[model samples]
Target chain A: MKYKAKVFVTLRPSVLDPAGTAVQSALTQMSYNVESVRIGKYVEMVLDATDESEASDRLHQACDQLLANPVIENYRFELVEAL
Target chain B: MKYKAKVFVTLRPSVLDPAGTAVQSALTQMSYNVESVRIGKYVEMVLDATDESEASDRLHQACDQLLANPVIENYRFELVEAL
Candidate 1:
């Protein structure tokens, strides 16, 4: 079976996100009533696997190995069986 | 009321994502059996609003004006009431 994963990589709450701060300031200049902004990554990947467990393992491995920096970022995923 | 919005900005189906391609190739080299990869942005914003409708409107405007390029990307958001 093929599984599709939607992975989200976000900076930890304790980590400082300069990019997000910059964007927030820019948005403020534009008069948007936003108090804070943070940016993260969303990744979609398709993997060939035998079942949900296998796909889940692979997705977690991918996130740990390549998709996120564990020291400062947190990653989560949603997996769905795909046709 | 305080609102938190999680916004997703993604490339349209027709747009090429070169960065995702590079990562896919790298993962393949590391022995991941992946078929496709696409990457996008996840934005978290905190807004001050009286209700959900106002928060939703402000979030959409922010996305359309600065967070996403409508010609080549699509954006969606989920808003939650926050303390």
Candidate 2:
């Protein structure tokens, strides 16, 4: 079976995010009344698996092992069967 | 009312993404069998709005005016009422 995973990688709340701050500043300069801006990584991938459960497990493993840095980053993913 | 917006910004298919390429190579090195990997930006923000439709409009405007470069990047967003 084929599955698609949408992974979101974000910095831990306690960590400083310079990129986010820069973006916020830019938005403010552009006259957008936004309170805050956060920048993170979104990854989409298709993978082979035996079943939905197996695909979920593999996606979690991928996020933990490669997609996100455990110390400073956190990740969440959603998986769906792909055509 | 308060609303939350999840924005995804990705390079157009025709554009070159070196960062995506580097991550794809890293994933391959880690022994993950993946067809391809695409990396993009994810942004989350909370804003004040009169209703869902207004929130959606503001999110779209934000993306078009600042969050994404329409020439090379494309964006999509989802909005939900915040508790």
- Scanning candidate 2 chain B in windows of ten residues, the lowest lDDT window is B28-37
Instruction: Report the TM-score of candidate 2, chain B only.
Output: 0.94
TM-score of chain A of each: 0.97, 0.96
Model 2 DockQ (Cα-based): 0.72
- Candidate 1 local lDDT, residue A14: 100
lDDT of 2 by residue, A12-81 (tens): 9999989988888887787666676678999988787889998888788888888899999999988888
Which pairs, if any, clash in model 2? none
Give per-residue lDDT, candidate 1, residue A76: 94
* Top-DockQ structure, candidate number: 1
Please tell me which predicted candidate would have the highest lDDT against the true structure: 1
What is the DockQ for all candidates, taken in turn?
0.88, 0.72
Docking class of 2: medium
List native contact recovery per candidate, as a fraction of 1.
Answer: 0.89, 0.68
Per-residue CA lDDT of model 1 for A1-83, tens digit only, reads 98999999999999999989999999999988788999999998999998999999988999999999999999999999887
Model 2 Cα displacement at B24 (Å)? 1.9
